[model samples]
Target: QPTLRKLVGGSSAPQLPDDSVRQLLVEADATNELFKYCEGQGYSLFVAAQPCSYTTQVVAGMIYTVSMSTEPDPGTYYEIKIFKPLPHLEQKARVTEIRMAQR
Candidate 1:
């Protein structure tokens, strides 16, 4: 199990940072989850995007918290939370929460 040594608190902590910060390790599954979430929420004009600056935690499965931007628009980012069950469970990823960042 991976333990968090220190947490970069707040939504702003995960924004695109310089070389010092780790880039979000985005997976296709997570991106797919975002697409599904946007569509389900009736976002008719949504753009396809790969969320950046993210973190994950392990519970019964994995929880992904990501920062996303659409259409290259600054301050138009959203903080999304997703839950992915362990592979052995063979469950689909689920979007748990969505918060618009105050960038």
Candidate 2:
């Protein structure tokens, strides 16, 4: 998977679209919050075992970058992150939301 940097082009493309960039950041923030919440609840967020590679998928014309982390010991938590750009609202706009499954 290519990092956003490469996809959006380098610093040379200074004029990167504002909306999409904003949405991508939003998704990152949401993912952070979700991880924090799980940790606070004393649950280990288990992504997946390596050589683990996160599968990035696009749905509804929006790009989704996903990865997993796992801590095996007592409690286990599953995290699914979805990043969707609201291109319809404004071209190059994205927002990320996350759903968690725990056992």
Instruction: Provide the overall lDDT of each model, using Cα atoms, as 2-decimal numbers.
Output: 0.60, 0.44
For candidate 2, write residues 12-100 as lDDT tens digits: 22232345443554545644665676687786655632111233444555444333335553344334445555566554433344444
Tens-digit per-residue lDDT, 1-103, candidate 1? 9875554442223445333222222333545655666678775436766456766676787766777776567766766777778889976666678766657
Clashing pairs in 1: none
The lowest-lDDT stretch of 10 consecutive residues in candidate 2 is: 8-17
Scored against the true structure, residue 5 in model 1 reaches a CA lDDT of 59
Count of backbone collisions in candidate 2: 8
Global Cα lDDT for candidate 2: 0.44
Lowest summed lDDT across 10 adjacent residues in model 1 is found at 19-28
Q: What is the C-alpha RMSD of each candidate to the true structure, in Å?
A: 7.3, 10.8
